[model samples]
Target: MESAFTKYTPTEPQIPPMCITLTKFLTTRIQETYNVCKRENPTNIKNCLTNPFEARHNYGLDNERNELIVYRHDIIGTFNSFEGKEFSMSPYTISRYEVIEKLGQGTFGQVFKCYDHINNRFCALKILKNKKAYLRQGLLECATLSMLNTYFDSNNDRIVKMYDHFMYCDHLCISFELLNQNLYQYAKERRHIGLELNDIQKKLIQLLEAVECCSKAGIIHCDVKPENILMTENGELKLIDLGSSCFENYTLYSYIQSRHYRAPEVVFNNRYNNAIDMWSVGCIIAELFLGVPLFPADSEFDLIVRFVEMLGMPSDEIIKNGKIADRYFKLVKRTNKYRLKESFEFEWENNIKLPPHKNYLYYSSLHDVIMKNPMKLSLNTKENNFIIRECLLDLLQRILVYDPKERLTPNQALNHPFFTFKNINDITPKDFYEWTPPEREFPFKVYGHSVSADPEDMLSDAFENKIIINKKLTNSEYYNVFFTLLQAGHVANITIDNPFEYGSITPKQFIRVFNHQFSKPSIPKVSTDVPRSFVAQIYSVTDSFNSVPIKKEENPLTIKHCNQSKIIIHRMTDNK
Candidate 1:
């Protein structure tokens, strides 16, 4: 049998700096691996390390722990194949941890339910893919987790407790205390019928406290959705998946958060801060009650449209300030105000059609969605229902504001009436709750653009305020052809004089670009029936000009995506 004290060291000459912190961990794991391997396979211990998969099969019958040795050499130099970079789910001994089964997978990598031989407990071991980019993100998560766990939640109460982090071959492996299940799964189990008010309050209060703790640490959990929040064995909540988190001072990525919970500022690609997280909180709270997403949008375009339908058009200043504002809103030359481009206009621009059952097409307002929730019928009385609904609506309105500056902070939200547990005896229909809502404001100048104090035109019910497009423009005519060219500033002007002669023009005669300066810039008009070639050229010119690099900036205070799998790996604990 191989010596129980034998330690298999990596043949790779130069180890990366990231593995330096794992020296002590690696030493302990090597000792544990050999000891476990010797006990499990005394006759042919050496052969187990040679091929761990075969070892797993050999020991499957006898060894109850199903122990199989995994060495640094097994994973480090392995080439990625068509099957992909995932390690097998057999009871492989990754360091000192004995993998029981695969739990879940996400953008980073797969998670495994493992038994810690040294600690004599179960844990969720997150195995990041061996790619360098994933490695960097994994390191950031480890650093953030280390900071939060050691400095803030040493008791393992608020944030998910990271037991240990180390390098297993080229993969960055992080072991976390086993958690029960995520909040999403919790909600799903209930058929998304919405949680009871009492239960909702308890979870919301706990989650708010967690958010406040992170805020105090200057960390922005860029992703704060139902899936990332895990429930403890005691039924308490702990925020997980800090991989997307970054310090408020040094916001790394602009593109953050899931599409459903994304803040309006983030959607606009404008400067954002911790308030963005608060926006997500409001969405979550609403979902907890409604049993469905408040704003379930198909795309970014659909999302903005929903925002308008629910809240209304943002102040003209905000509309003008957004980086990609022009994509969704058109500046009315006469009014000098921004109008949300008609849904059909976006369809024309992107060449993608939206389904009829979009949320915006059904829901009239944000208030309407909340008030009409069927879950409220479960309340004992109309008075009780009214109190609960009013309190929630008031809180949500404050958090889901268009401007982040106007949105409630985590601390402030904790103090809101929604979190206040009122006695049922004190509740009376005559005594209604009322408080002055925070005045919407844009206090700071953005990109040399002054805040528009045009209160008269600030908010418009989008359902009532509709932009009529020409009836002659059919989807087929606009679908396969034509792009937009900017007629914003003084440049070369190519005006199609006669709409009737558009179809007769050949490909070469399509664009007659000449230096025809107008008294003022005009919004480019889409012809009813322009040839595809002419439309394409105009769009091509617009794209070239739009490609010019503009300065991109993030909020200095808190400014913190693609839909990765909703399942959270590190927090999956039900397999145990």
Candidate 2:
């Protein structure tokens, strides 16, 4: 995927004949608007260009002027489109576009690679799954894209371009410009060698820029993983998938984000905000450097333990405010009253040790973990490298804070030295230059279709369920081992305990056990730093709050309170 545009010799963007008419109308309309606005206020055009929230393009018949005028919205490059397009009966047919092949499927629905028959160009079509209730979600995506489309630069547009959307066969179909691939796939190819730190930083700049634009738009992209970011031929990054986005005025969904990118607030079911995205950004940035997920956990509890190992327990305010803190953390009254809960956890975890698991946080620190592992930080081993290592960790800490209120916003992040840093090593040797197709913008660069993708393909391959049948144990036998674990000073629901009572638990049964856990897990620490925010399409079903048929409580674990500091789970017996 090579660029097609070069300075003044930019490639002519592909547009259907009808779109040409719309473009003319839009251009005339914009000129008229500028003329009228300039007569009233001299700085109107400048404001329109600079004001990110300002409306960029408006399409309508100019009844006042007795003519139809359209102001073309030139995003990364220039693109022209017409609204209210009608498609044929075929699912693949959408106006003048023909479906090529299915590109991918996501939480929103299926995305197809399509060709614009009229323009002889390729585009992507997102066909909303036919659900009457999900129409609102489609509309939310429309609103978000509309806001993003107008906020554009010649080649600096961050979000994917949405050309048009329409209803067909009871399903909402959206047409977007076809992209090359995504960051996830791109990163996977080079995970072993990994991307240069400078290149990684550049990618973050593009992603964070998109994030900042969302903040300016007053929208939250609840999901912000590598899979959602597309990379173009010219190395342009575009953020896609807005089905879960919501406005700042209200939250739509409570349960949001994928397992790995999930913020502490999301895991705890606490009140969340834009900070959630920042935490994900931190995770993404680390992966870009390490070529793997920063914290890849088998279970949610394991992720919490990783946090404890790196950063220690979250602040007391985080624990208290968390909606489901009891599900993971055991809040014991302190014997040392003078020490704050957070301070005590940090100090005692680092100092005191009574047995095999006296304090969880004592296991390792951020420096120890990175120094032990093979990361970008581990590559540089000079004693003077502490400053650079701290620089990298400092950036991670700012974004991965437990309290969303304290997390670094995209605005603050862009100013951080990590993004602004210019490495001396970036300069290439005069004789050793890497050559490629010349950097030129393509005909489709700005109009339709989009960037690349970065999905976690290796995530599935990370674990192997290879049990060699070393011994055959009954369900009762498995339960007996767990019972013994509980009897020997093990705690259920604590981050330390593996809560799988049996060898198998269905998603429903797992949720049930998770909902019942007493000791809560603290938000994972980011080596002492992050917060997260989310915009939801539907936080939860309205009926989730309604009355339900009550059933006898299922006590999976029978525990007796030994005291405020201790509890005992009675062993399971093979009784007749």
Candidate 3:
């Protein structure tokens, strides 16, 4: 599609209306030119003035012949004494790029879709404005791009890759890999319909990975709204626009991030870290699910109020640390409690007439907002859908934490339960193949790996359909295993050859063997209930816990098995 800006015709330069007066200022200079069209021999041109100022007009003087001699196209373009901030049009070449059309415009400069003659491919050429401050910012963008493109973005897929950068027509032009529409445009094209849960999950995984990459480089992507994330044809997201980015330790601006996605620390002008990006990520995820921004505010004050409504009030410590906290909050002298200053009262302090607060729909917490969202999940059962929502909400709560120090890091979010397949039925072939196993933990060493007693690291994906023996399972864990197995198609007989001296088994001794021989295939579900006689043989009649077990009186619940389509576990043997 053509840009909204008027196309500049070669015959008439599309200068701004305000610049029209400059033509009269340079009229005397233009009149000094000789009419080459009226020469004794038209081929032999007479002296024509080539003053820099006359170039703004498309043609040289033809007062005598009253016809054009030197067309604007005849002269070679130079940077010296350029008039407007942007290049005129395509059919124009800047260095090796053949400018096709204007793609976009930002504070730094205008971006054009150009043909890279050398590479024989299309690229986005970002040409900085011919102004000092913009040029400086553009150069900084180039440096950050150079660092990321060289060291961090080794895959060339996480972030928008920069190809070449150079000065063209006195503008610092940086060429980047051309990508599809940004996320904002993508959602808009879909009429603001929320994305599918699976799609949102996939995008979040990639987005978090991208953010983690940025964190590794110690660069803060000061602006990370939907507009800054571009979707490839395959639907993979690539982060773009790091013009406002700065090193984590050397943040250049207190005012950063889009209003809706802005972190609280930024809103209060407090010291922020990489956690600010996580907050933005949380907002984006919420928006992706709701088909709109999580917090759409007309002003910073409104944004703070939304934050308060959606995520409770910030801790006193957090508010106290804010550099500009006094602008929005006042410390009560008697109680030392911070109170939100009224918007009208701040008008005098800031010398700006502030609008009255708009009545906003209130949510007790982010959980309430997410629960209210009409999210459609692929799960067949409502219970499964609710489970997914709750898992996602847990992750978002940590990400949207008011305190930067307590907010979830990209690495931590990657490990959140939402990304893991808690249900066997939810496990896709893709999920299995792409699954990364966490470090294992057990009381004793297994598979040449060190052992730890920590219960948190003990459970892995393979142990989802686990068997608990003398060790009674908690209600939550028991139900989790039951539901997981209930979804499985086949039940395999798991036999234990030997048990400890006490003739008892515990989860800590449940060695996870990655042997491929014990592949479990899904078949059909077994009966939900069994006779007491049948239950007695499989499970020990224990008063402490209520669990169904397979009958094996001689065997003391030694083998823990999973009901799965492909359950591969090798039997563990003790060394003599």
Candidate 4:
């Protein structure tokens, strides 16, 4: 067997200053590389560090522990693959740690179970893949853990604690207190189709608590599948993998949440919230009961169809607002209804073109699917089973609400009778925490003279109040005014026009480049809803512009569609 570490003389190498501050005691060149590695996305962070390079600070003598605290990172020819660690004379030379076996691989790193010589304990060592970007993501995971660690202390076993962090084979490594097989493995071994009610309840309660702690710090475990959950020797569970998480309201990337457990808001492309986590909670619970994914689809279109079939078609407003709706649904102008595009062609032998895409559509009920599918697990007595099944389904519906606004928060799920818990407030974190993220640079610049994205809109259920302003104003200024009306009037979401560059032009932008003045501004008491594309074409003016009367002309203007609801603009008249 290879011994842990080979002797090395104490020395410090010249290194540049780094941005991150994980440790203050160490000063070495490798430390700087660790900092740069953190700025990248975890998946590709290994590509950032190119140089095999100078020695990094891998070990520090701990006076209190009376042992060497090691962080190993070796790259280039010095360190081969993880397989080579078995041959190295000094393999993973921590104070008293012995390498046992490889645990598993993560999104961007590998994990190993090591026996600690000093503490005589087994801990999980996560060796990150070499790359500056991946290093940064790992650092983020550490930061997230750091925040959670404050809530849990040395005695508390509520969650997995990061024992220490170091560099191993040019990869950032985080040490976690050792945990047993995750719930997935346990379920697979014991309960193939579904887990018992009691087990599900116990597991959910602890998992929910972990989620609560994360939300307390405004964290979102974007990936919340069973593989990320580890079980303790006891029945208690621990939520692992902080690497893929982000803050609650904001997202680091659009692609988040595992697809099978993905919430509708995330699927349809709407602004999301912490409720996305609860949605996963529902899927997991149902999967435990049914032994398969509740909503399984190979593609986004199929997923939408599943939802539509189960819950009925969503509102027109929802269909339009969804970023990906047009890809799956066809709008019927005459009927004023949206229909699902042909997901699959049936009656193929007949070559039925007459039926059309809309003709072959039918929606199945949610309750019906659950009962008919292979997922219906038989419980105890029919009476007892019926009651339990009803409660579980109810909980699932609330968590799986299509509108994120209506979806149950983690706290709410705690109170659901499905968990046999009553007071939702019982799970509220004692210490609430949040952080202001750095300013977000514009996501992706739209390259065009006229950006076709949604502009600010002023929509309301009642179009009775119409306050018109000048036809000529900057799009930015119009957007400013759009929000001003909402703040001033107190309104919710609304819709507006979307015609070409402005599509017929939505939230139409009026430019004043013609240099002709208007006949004073007028506020019209508009009726119900504004037509989708309400275009204003300037026709023949009074002969010679004498009778028409022109006010002082302003600068040329460009119209931008207000992405919101219906809004009408007119210059105010000087009349009573």
Best by TM-score: 1
Q: Cα RMSD (Å) between model 3 and the true structure?
A: 29.5
Candidates arranged by TM-score, highest first: 1, 3, 4, 2
Question: Who wins the lDDT comparison?
Answer: 1
What tens-digit string does per-residue lDDT give for candidate 4 at 150-255? Answer: 4332244555787655433335566789999987787777654445556667888888887776765556677787888898888788888888775442355567
Model 3 segments beyond 4 Å from truth? Answer: 1-95, 191-193, 356-364, 376-383, 422-576
Q: Taking the tens digit of each residue's C-alpha lDDT, what string does model 1 give over 1-576?
A: 877897878764335332442454345344434544564565445533322333332212112223223422222211221111122111112335666666776777767777777668888888765544565566557545655675556577789988765544335567888998898888778753435666777888889878876766556798999998999888999999888876554455678999999998888888766677888989899887777787888788888888898898899888788898888999899998889998899889989897664543235587877776565223433446766677677788888999877787777776665665555325443333455433323232222111211211211211112122222322112111111111111111111221111221111101121123322122222222322111111113234311112122311000111111111111111111
**C-alpha lDDT of all candidate models, in order:** 0.56, 0.50, 0.55, 0.49
Who is ahead in lDDT, 1 or 4?
Answer: 1
Descending-lDDT candidate ranking? 1, 3, 2, 4
Question: Any idea what lDDT model 1 has?
Answer: 0.56
Per-residue lDDT of candidate 2, residues 382-478 (tens digit) = 4334444456666677777777766777877776666655762332332112212222111111111111111121111111211111122222222
Runs in model 1 with CA error above 4 Å? 1-95, 192-194, 353-357, 360-362, 376-383, 424-576
Q: Model 3, range 446-485, lDDT digits (tens) per residue?
A: 1111222222222222234333332232211122222223
Model 4 ranges off by over 4 Å? 1-97, 152-158, 192-194, 344-365, 371-383, 421-576
Per-candidate TM equals 0.60, 0.53, 0.58, 0.54
